[model samples]
Target: MSLRSSYYLPPQQLRAENLDSPLGLHTRNPQLSWKLRWNERGAAQATVRVVAAASCSALLNRDYLWDSGELRTDATEITYAGATLTSRQRVYWQVQVLDESNRITQWSEVTFFEMGLLTLEDWNSQATWLGNHGITVPLYRLSFHLDQVREDICTARLYSTGIGYYEPRLNGNKLGTQALAPEYTDYDKRIVYNTFDIEKQLCSGENVLGIILAGGYATRYQYGTPVFRAQLEILYHNGQQQLVDTASGPWLVSPGPWRDCDIFNGEWYDARLEQRGWDAPGFIAHEGIWQEVKPSNPCSSTDAPKGELVGTYAQTVEPPK
Candidate 1:
């Protein structure tokens, strides 16, 4: 008398901020998560239904913009508040879990998130602010070319910021090791930006975008002004939009092996000015110094655009490390 007990298994990894179907997800309150495997193994969570859209047939024709509905609250993450998502805006979501014997699980697979630059005028992106500024470990090189116009990218975003630790590369690989990224905010009042999902790091025309910076804690404890900002947006397939920003035109600022990264003082690499491969894939830097990225600071319109400080409304951690 148990034909799978009337079945209700669906609900698998539909994350957002915790990232699983993430793409450009620079958090606009985005949290929503999920996971449920059953054969009747404690199948809890009595209800859930999330729906947000701008596409995917307007999220299965509900024509939704936001619909939390069910929610009996067993909560996996859930914290998006509905409407107001800007930059690149690419929403699309889905969820429907209702177990605890109520049995109802079949709407869990569509997920999306594209939005990035939440403010600072959504950064018109003049794309400057790069650096070498002495000592080393700064290497920056950006080479671009990705036309393929019949539209086929369909979303590929990567924003950036750095005063300290950074590591990025495409075309020649090396993107996620996930250490100390564009994090550690408080830089003049909240300056952190990171959103990636290069659509499998992109391919359709020559591509390159390498950067390397050091000094953590935004410059350990003293001399500061080591800056970098980058942006890459490609959402084609006919809709049109291709931007490979930052200082807008020419870049190649080298100085590797970090002569002094100074996180607290103690890192000076110089394998004889090592430049081996330099992250491969069509490498070119006939010899450094082509710079144009400026402004490591002094761009504050009122700072606080980390997707409005990522939240369900609760800010207060005065040293709760």
Candidate 2:
């Protein structure tokens, strides 16, 4: 169930790799990287059939745009050769494979990825650095009112990123089971942001959006600083909208736990410095110390933000990492 924590990947399916419904996604072919377990009885991937479509439901029904019929290859990185992908174009795909023993496995679950702003104009929104550009760890928070919570709230995407690592919370609940935000990549070359669907995570009135970042590669082992940016867009069924973005919003960046957190030295947390409920709405400390965020590129020569992230996540099962 590594692909999806909720469901078991059917037998015969390769352990999916590089197919994590990626974000800040880019690539002409959008390669498919995956692997399978060996049964020790000569079990190996002999052939694979890939199906691609614009939607998930359409994929299972055989209503697809492209089909890679039983190609014999053990190559993990299978590039999408079906259609040209445009900016913000979302594609869903799944594959089934043939084993050496002529055993055909059930189709795997659908995996998807969306293209980022393909052109400069597509990036209508500006970038923002989450907090002070010199601190080691920074935790930002924003509280807003929903006015009216409707079940029709369909599209809710919190596109977020931070130098090193980040953990976003809505109403105190973590965005996903996955610990790491955006996948690991070379920060100098590219920065990955995560898109979360938070429709059910919202309430009728007051809500909180808190994000924390720690030095991952951003600091290069504490040799640099941490940075952050995020954009939230929500679409209501009645055509109404709400947005909470770091570029221009009520987000307040302030100091947080972790006296020192680095990739190599690890994090040092003093229980006495902890501020309970700091991430929840209506709770603010060191008020004057907080400051507004600004726009800055994580992959550019611009200075990075500072602060100790909450936790390392996988390595430490704590929040705000």
Candidate 3:
């Protein structure tokens, strides 16, 4: 039997809720109503389109429309039904609004999102990461190696970090100490030299050269805090002794070269020998062989011995007898 369908109105009307809407809350307010429409935008499914509107009885006129596309007002919305956005995809979107007079409002803010494909060049202009370590200044030590059979000279270079001082050593010998003084004419400056001849001390082949950098300042200490220090060692053989150390004193008193005084000065030799004292005499052996020997004659003429002149020397051979 054909029956006529009848529709009955419920006590409350069904209302759709839009979580993204910025309008004030009004429970069951007839004067204000908003409808929402959405569509997937973009070929890669990376964008989304959202539309909102207010209406009475007829189809609600969309007052605002947002599209995830070119981020411009005229840009078309993207659509992706079954595809998912890839990691390398970049997305952009914008919003459009309409007023009560049905006049279309200007597009709202554009939003953009990108994924993956990050480059270091984008961050190169930024500061260095935390926990970076490096040298703050330059320093050095000069010494020689005696254990080496080939005889080699060793040198050490050091740097300061705006605090403390350092001492350098080569082989087992201590080159010198780099100390910082407040009242001194120069402070915290590096010293350099052209070349150090440790051949007198250095021996051939495998030699262990070392540098002891003391970072603690005696004057700056308050109580029991030990100063910071670093030690570096290198193994090298016979090679050219190249001076790479430089001076960087802060005092403006003198223009003279400081390194030359410390390294080139003949004091290093005297200091080494004097420090060793009696022990040095044992290490060095003297050969009795004389280069020239002549009889001592007090009565002989001072002009010339016999017939020999200053620049003339006679070689004699014994007869076969």
Candidate 4:
């Protein structure tokens, strides 16, 4: 057979640490894997080359963070041994392969993985847990102005977790498409935080972040009130960075429509109690309606549910259409 036709298709189903292009990868050195597709009965991968870069264009230009020069092995998975990874770092990668007969395939499509906070200290020292102590289910909002930011935003990420379940919104829209997050865990033992890319959700002038909290694990298992902690990191093209977290910003909280919410007992929401435009920019609540959020914890002691904080690496659940 001609070399052109004999070459197997580029590797497919690229994954990092067994997750497809996962975000918030907590591992400092994650394993990479791919599947080989070929019609030949005896088709086999004889050699492989993997390249990782900070960006797609950099990968295309061969400015790689790490390159596994061709290895004469049939393994479909390899460990990443690149430059030290840092919090919120994004790495793009691709692979090339050679068939048993040494016929080569084109570079595989690029995929990426984003590093999660590597240490507990990665969280801002001032970031604190905030909650509405008197409300069953609370809607929290933080409004900020970005007009004063002189540098263009390169990217933005939101790292958050709640003692209960949470749905985070930016500018009146949900931050991610998934629901039922930050993934359920034993509140007293461990808590999982989710990372969301919010670059597109941010506006130039003013932006409002809204979070709806429901009693999931905190109330159901821990028998305590729900609280949330989050930080929004904005990176600028000029290397400047900005952070908006629960502690640094003036945040407001109000009772939400969801009442008597429980993961096992079910939730109660009253449309009549809905506060319209509460999550939108320029919306004002009555003086007594929305109040400042107080620092709260699931346990009586400070920062209760005093457990290990971890990044969500497992698959997220999707709400039904």
Candidate 3's C-alpha runs over 4 A off are 1-163, 176-197, 217-321
Candidate that scores best on TM-score: 4
**lDDT (10s digit) by residue, model 1, range 163-266:** 66678787777675465566666666565656666787767676778888787875565336566667776778777787775564465667776677666667
Clashes of 4: 0
lDDT values, one for every candidate: 0.66, 0.63, 0.24, 0.80
Q: Against the hidden reference, what TM-scores do the models get?
A: 0.32, 0.69, 0.19, 0.89
RMSD of each: 16.5, 7.0, 35.0, 3.1
- Give the lDDT ranking, best first: 4, 1, 2, 3
Q: Write the per-residue lDDT of candidate 3 for residues 174-244, one digit (tens) a residue.
A: 44222331111112232111111234444354333322222233223421111222222222365543322
lDDT of 2: 0.63
For residue 319, give model 4's deviation from the true position in Å: 0.8
Q: How far is candidate 1 from the true structure (C-alpha RMSD, Å)?
A: 16.5
Q: Model 4, 201-270: lDDT tens per residue?
A: 7877778989888777777676467878788888888777888756756788888887678777787778
Which is the winner by TM-score between candidate 1 and candidate 3?
1
Candidate whose lDDT is highest: 4
- Shift in Å, residue 74, candidate 1: 19
Error of 3 at 260 (Å): 33
